[model samples]
Target: MRLRVHRRGLFGWEPGEDALAGAAVTTTECRNIDLDRMLDPARGNLVIGARLPHMSLVFDRDARGPGHHLIELDDLTTKSFARLDWPTDSTEPFTISQLGPRRL
Candidate 1:
């Protein structure tokens, strides 16, 4: 997938064109990612049983983190998915980490 930036940069990765000055920059990105290899069965509740459906696993990029977490089955796509919650006493970052995006 290609990353199209409108402004300078979202996470300071690349320089964006000045839209006000009528300048636009385009960049291309090609990734050969494997969803199966990046999946987390234990935490993601991907166990096959009577309750668990025999379907494909889906993953989404952690918008607020540096990794990706399991979302839901693609066949039954939904925005709402089960998330792992942290303890109230913990001072960790407000983001979940499953598998980091690999550049392979």
Candidate 2:
């Protein structure tokens, strides 16, 4: 699963609230957006931060068990318009933020 932002003006995205189509974000600025603080995975549940309303957290069924589990982000709505395979399992306390119009 992967985290994807919905296309602006589509369903969940309103016209003025849509992501800047071709805006570019610097890598330095990207580092400031904290995924852990946003998701708060340590709280024993999924948390959606105010800044990233379009993103969602996903986990495999096994992850729901009683343990520090690895999971995946649902990428069905990614800017790429496709999902990415989890090359390796991802543990909690990770961050995902949109750095630019097409970069996440």
Candidate 3:
């Protein structure tokens, strides 16, 4: 399943937030954000951080085990949060703050 974000407000809707919400469809297949090379200053320009309330992960039932997982962002920080293990076979949507390692 593909996660998609929908805009509610008139304009300037948050894409990241939308993506997170869409992830709920299949939380099991969704995994943590890959931030291996996101730390690069050059890449930073493409990695725009946003204040998202939640994130969702979509999964395939027949192909996989469970379904998916969702994550809520309480706060924003430039620290790398470890990948969360799902209770069942599922996916989870996460933000950059939830993935990348903390910069010293």
> Which one wins on lDDT?
2
Question: Model 3 reaches what TM-score against the true structure?
Answer: 0.18
Please provide TM-scores, in order, for all candidate models, with all chains considered together: 0.21, 0.25, 0.18
Residues 1-104 of candidate 3: C-alpha lDDT, one tens digit per residue: 22121222222322363444433222233333333233233452123222232222222222323433322222123322222323233233432223333311
Q: State how far residue 35 of model 3 sits from its true place (Å).
A: 24
C-alpha lDDT score of every prediction, in listed order: 0.28, 0.32, 0.29
**Candidate 3 Cα lDDT to native:** 0.29
Q: Which digits, one per residue and each the tens of the lDDT, describe model 1 over residues 31-100?
A: 2132333343543333421244322333445633545342322112221122222222334442222211
Residue-level lDDT tens digits of model 2 in 4-93:
322232334221214433333222222212423433555423433224455434443334354333332222244422111221234323
Error of 3 at 65 (Å): 7.1
User: Which whole-number lDDT from 0 to 100 does residue 35 have in model 3?
Assistant: 31
1 versus 3: better lDDT goes to: 3
- Stretches off by above 4 angstroms in model 1 are 1-51, 54-57, 68-104
